[model samples]
Target chain A: MEKFGTLTAIAAAYPKVNVDTDLIIRVERCAGTPREALGPWAFEMVRYRPDGSEDPGFVFNREPWREAKILVAGENFGTGSSREMAVWALARMGLRCVIAPSFGEIFFGNCLQNGLLAIRLPADEVRRLMALASAPASATFTVDLARQTINGTTRFEISPRPKRMLLEGLDELGLTLAMEPEIAAFQAMDRPRRPWIYL
Target chain B: MGRSLFEKLWDLHVIAELGDGMQLLHVDRHILNELSGSRAQLDNAKRSLKPRHPQLTLGVADHVVPTEPGRAGDKTPWAKNVMQIFRDESRRDGILLLDVNDPDQGIEHVIGPESGFTLPGTLLVCGDSHTCTNGALGALAWGIGSSEVCHVLATQTIVQPKPRSMRARFEGALPPGVTAKDLMLALIGKYGTTGALGHAVEYAGAAIRELEIEGRMTLCNLSIEFGAKIGMVAPDEKTYAYLKGRRHAPQGALWDQALAHWRTLPSDPDARFDREVALDCSGLVPQVTWGTSPEDVIGVDGRIPDLKPEALAYMGLSPGQPLAGTRIDRVFIGSCTNSRLSDLRAAAAIARGRRVAAHVEAWVVPGSMRVKREAEAEGLHEVFRAAGFQWREPGCSMCVGANGDLVGPGERCVSTSNRNFVGRQGPGARTHLASPATAAACAVAGEITDARTL
Candidate 1:
């Protein structure tokens, strides 16, 4: 996992609500593609046309935005499926942060696990960010994880553990395994209480 | 204040609290399917880590496996390879694999509870979102991502922030023809997709208690559709009766002890929830989606709302158009959400004396091999076949379409699956979410027609 710190980069604005994971990376893409190689296929449905040409109207296909490292989106972004490939595709596509009004619960967690910052703000704040990101000159935004702010002004809140995980690039599995004695103790106590589950 | 069922489940599973509201919760049961589990297991192996508790984990080849007859030897090259990988990985990790030819093989969510691997007060995790379906057994189950999947394999625990609790009380008896599927759709339709975001939802009240185990599973299955990762119904006599004598269920003295623990798994009378929602199932009718999202639903007799022009364009539907009477090209009566024997019987009842319309292709893919066997023994498959509905083997056919069972592009389909997202069935496929009976009626009528009217 990549450690998340302060990142200042070009941002793309897509203000569509309920853009599900299927739309982000289609099911067909997930079937064959390796995780790291899914960058080009992210948002393939809207990114291309029937002729296999890029959809110029799409935010990512246009100038400057094609290299965007951040996204300002509408409410309930990444709203369906528990597929982590959606997060991987976005991260591979070079997005470091996503500012939205809301997000799917699992998608949000997947983002934290992958070190992609998913920040939820008020709808109005997201709209403000989206407006700023719509233009090439104003699209460059800063996301500081240590300071818990975006663009050095708008504040965001994340639970402390995830915040720390992102800042330190901590492997959660390793962290949990470090407390092996606690886990073993819990299992020992729980085994007698529910003997059947031990199998 | 008394504790909610969610709180009790949390307290029981917590191995250690890692500060900032996160707790490392022990996973009592872990189920993996081919599509998601293969990657996790492979990644864990690459990292030189072994499964901490492989005995508690089970693997099934369902997501991308073919559901056609004689599919054991015939599958797409990709699916065959995926299944082989899943088999190899499960073997190497010392986990049990219910392979394509296993009699108990099915969608993980469906077979887990059916085999008694899912139990009350236990914590279950799967890579697929519909894992919440197992929560109907009073288990604390939710879907996890691939990374989290690898984490669980290595530690037998998942780090999670405790979610707030919400209780949805369905008071009153459901009217005839209005099934649990209808009740859930009505709830999602009333409260948008994110209604239960960040909350653990518990279904309670008269209607919930009255529902059978399968019906409760159907209700809890769509909790993710409403943006709730965890959804459950408190265990009762119905839950216990359904679990008793199942393959993995406890026997003898263990059964008595388990029953005592399960009895205490429900929320206390004075328990409090962070949020409360009440609905009257007495008025709920059959629901059908008119747009791309699951929440873009209306009763079969209701008209489509004038919002979401993009969804309207994609679905080729007009505002104010009644959901019923819309032409459908196909009807899919299966998925983890509604592929149990009861669901098959419901659809079979509607198709018993009626033939599928000539233009409509109808398929009934059972949730599990057990469900398929039971339905066939009950002659439901014969009824479906006589009615011109194809009766296929058990898998998640046409639901995600990863198995090559897809609705055609531009074709409108009424499905009993949980999701109605864009391109979920297939690219350019317009899907209307409905119950098995409603989908069966649509096939017979060649349009979206209410089962009650049929």
Candidate 2:
């Protein structure tokens, strides 16, 4: 997993709300392809034409924005589908962070697990960022995980464990094993209490 | 203080609080499917982490399996490999696997309940988001990521923060012809997709209680679409009766004990939730999506919503345009959300004497092989076939655009699946989500139409 500390990159603005996983990466695109090949197909529906030509007018395909490593999207970004391939597609597409007013629960979890920063800010701040992102001259934004701030526009909130995980590059496997003793103790007591569940 | 079901379920499974609201929660049951589980992950973990409780876990092959018989199975190398991986790993790990030919094979959510692997008052986790479908039985179930899957396989536990609780209480009765899918879409339409973000939602009140176990599952299955990881319904006599005599359910004396425990799973009268919303389903009508998101829905009789320019362009809809006469190119009636016997029966009834329109391609993929066999025994297959709908094998087919089943580019489809997001059915395909009956009606009409009118 990539350790996320700080990132400074051009941000692209996509103001469409409910940018679901299906829009991010189609199920068929993710089905048989290698994870690495998913980047080019990210947002393929809007990004390309039926003839496979790029849609020059789409936000991600526009100048400066095409090189953007940060995405400022509308609220409820990443709703629908639990496929982590959505996050993989974004990260593989060179996006290190996604800023939105809100996000789907599973998508938020997937972002953190895959070492991508998902920042939630006030709607006003998101709108402001969206404007800045759309204007190429002010498209650059910096995300500082240590300070829990984005472009110094707002103090973001991320749970401490996730913050630590991002900083240290620790995955859940190691952390879960650290609590094995406690898990065993709970199971010992729970087994007899819910015997029917075991069978 | 009285406890809500969420509180009770969370407190019961917490192994340790890792600070910052995170906890190591024991997973009583973990389910794996081809979409989420892979041979590579399991093979890598085997070097250090053997499945601690193989008996508590089961493997399901659903995602990439061919829903049609005798096709090159290798249509997509990626899918074929993943399916093989699931089979190889499950056998090596000594985990019970329901392969394509297995009579018990089906979508994980459907098989979980029908096979009795999902029980009330236990915690269940799967790698797919719709794992919440199992929560209808009063179980505390939610979807987890692959890393969490590996953790559960190694320790039978997952580390996570407990989510805040929210409840949507549905008052009044749904009008005839409206199903759980309609109620869910209506709720999503009202609240938007992010309405339940960061919280576990409990479906309660008169309307929820009135639903049968299958209906309840359909409601919870789409909870993920509403941005909630968990969607639950407290168990009742309906739940108990549904689970009785299932292969994995407790028998006789054990059943009695289980029943006694389940009776205590509902939220106490005075229990509190962090958030609450009430939706009255008094006159709710069948719903269909006009835009990509599930939240972008309207009643069948209503006009397309005034959505943003981008959505309108993508969906090929104009503001206030009547949604009824929109042409449809395909109709899909399968997915964990609405592929059960009742769903099939509802669609079959609509297609009993009608024929699919020449311009429309229609398919009915049953939720499970068991469901397929039963539907065939009842001659449901003949109804669909007689109406020009292809009756296929049990699995996630057009729902996820896998298994070589896909809607052509720029084609319009009315689907019973949970999502209608861009490219969900295929690249450049426009999907409008509806209930099985509505989809069946659309197939016959060659356009989006109200099932009630038929």
Candidate 3:
């Protein structure tokens, strides 16, 4: 069940950290709007306007991230309310992997449930990538998770389990079902031999 | 080989190790509330799994319960059915169920730790993100989704991958008006929103040592904001004494043994971390978030920063405006983050017969019936009601904005709730996050004001 996917694209620019749930997706949008509406509403607090138009100098909208597939952000990237819509918005925006220093608990759960990859690189290493990703052209870096290295020149390795989950796209449920036989066998053990309570 | 608390807890609960960083973990505590119950029931029907460890799990009617206990059914028709089913299922399984009328019933996370279910060196899980709040007791804890809730209910174990570790050292004393909420908000500002991604943050240092157990719980509650699984304050006498005499705590000789081991759970002087973040608590003022993000804060003496054109248009706040002078239409003081007695004391010290501004609507909700009872016993409720603030029952209330109590569209509020994200308080409602004292002063002045105002 373990699977891994390489970064198809890199979207990098640091926004002010601690982005919360409601700001990622409006309740109005979650009520009836098409799921894809999440992309347009992706950073509502940062992207919202009475008349929608691009703010050329905006960090996410500026330069390269116009079609970012992977988003690299600052620390505590998804802290705030427990709105699942935030994950929906980021996923809809085609952000498959978020390599950051940290993430909000609810947002992290939401992402894992939806099969998004949230990788934690050290702050120093993430800072290096952020610096490289922000540069106009030469600042570009690659996240070759398959190789277990992040950048071409200054490669970094990921720990085993996260790498496995990311590569295989297996969630906790999938991981558990893989052990059905063992669980059943444990359950089937005779009541008399280990009779702690009634079944 | 050395194992972190993660590896140790993971090893203790491992029912079967499926290769490659996954294992079936025996869930020690299965915490449930209104929102999780509905989704879990639906998923269970689809999956056809019976209850696994119902005795190990506990349910409370909070998320959808109204602040007024009698009108619980009217809170939401959706919640009515959900709460009914939660009651029915728990009764069916003989599980511990604390519905709205129960003494322990409150926001599931807040009551879990305070009422004695949460303990040291254990695993506690809840469907609410703030469940990480229990990690303050030195346990390994985190939040899960509804489907995960269903899975855990059907099978006490949840499968999870390990996360990296980060250590946050908080040094120094908090000046008189500062509370744990202010310290957490200050950490968010310095670290930005995404600063602690995928790392288990261990909070230690002078300020952390000085904090009361409940205050430390407040500190750990907002870890989700910084993108961490949980935050921990190493077990100390404060933690032991708080847990003592609670219904779930160990007794007599067992207590001596547990305390002896729990005392050693703190990190050694030489323990290394993938990352380290530190804060000096004294300099932080009563903090509040002016923008959507929790870290989007300015001190009580500060002004909201000028925003980019889009941010300016999204939130109606104009750039470069002084936060202290910005009028707030609503003021709320309650949530797991700031509904404890200390929070009320802070807010009431600022309110106390000071008429709330003509333009502001204020609410002071105690975290639990227990908290409300304690506050009322101490006359804190009088201080609140005297200020024209609505005194409400113990429930999540406006924290999740689940019930109808919410700020009107386009109206601005200074709230004691954790998040200030858009609509976090209500649809199209603008929110500014502040500590209880700040919220109280804002209500009195109809603008963001210092809690220490003369």
Docking quality tier of candidate 2? Answer: medium
Candidate 2 lDDT, tens digit per residue, A52-81?
Answer: 899997988888888999999988998877
- As for DockQ, the candidate ahead, 1 or 2, is 1
Give the docking tier of candidate 3: incorrect
Stretches of model 3 off by over 4 angstroms after superposition:
A1-19, A23-109, A115-171, A177-199, B1-24, B68-75, B307-309
Q: How far is candidate 2 from the true structure (C-alpha RMSD, Å)?
A: 1.9
Instruction: At residue B353, give the lDDT of candidate 3.
Output: 70
Strongest candidate by lDDT = 1
The residue-by-residue lDDT of candidate 2 on B169-228, one tens digit each, is 999998999999999999999997888888899999999999999999999998998889
Worst 10 residues of 3 chain B by lDDT: B1-10
All candidates' TM-scores?
0.99, 0.96, 0.79
lDDT tens digits, residue span B1-454, model 3: 3445544444545677656765666667778876655556555756666676676687877776778535443535555666777777667656788777777777777788877777776677887778888888988888876657877887767776666788788888889988888899999888966677667888888999889988888889888776676788887888888889876666776667667766666666666678889999868788988777777787988866775454455467777777788777999898888898888888899888799998888998888778888888999989888889989877887777776677887988899888776677776777888888889989999887888763
Q: Order the numbered candidates by DockQ, best leading.
A: 1, 2, 3
| iRMS (Å) per candidate | 1.1, 1.4, 5.1
lDDT of 3 by residue, A1-199 (tens): 2254556575566645555556577544543344457677877655644457766656668767766666778766676655465777788876776777766656766676666777677788777777767776744446577775665554555546656666777666656666667666654552232222121
The lDDT for every candidate, in the order shown, is 0.91, 0.88, 0.73
Per-model DockQ: 0.78, 0.71, 0.22
Top model by DockQ, which number?
Answer: 1
* Alpha-carbon shift of residue B419 in model 2 (angstroms): 0.7
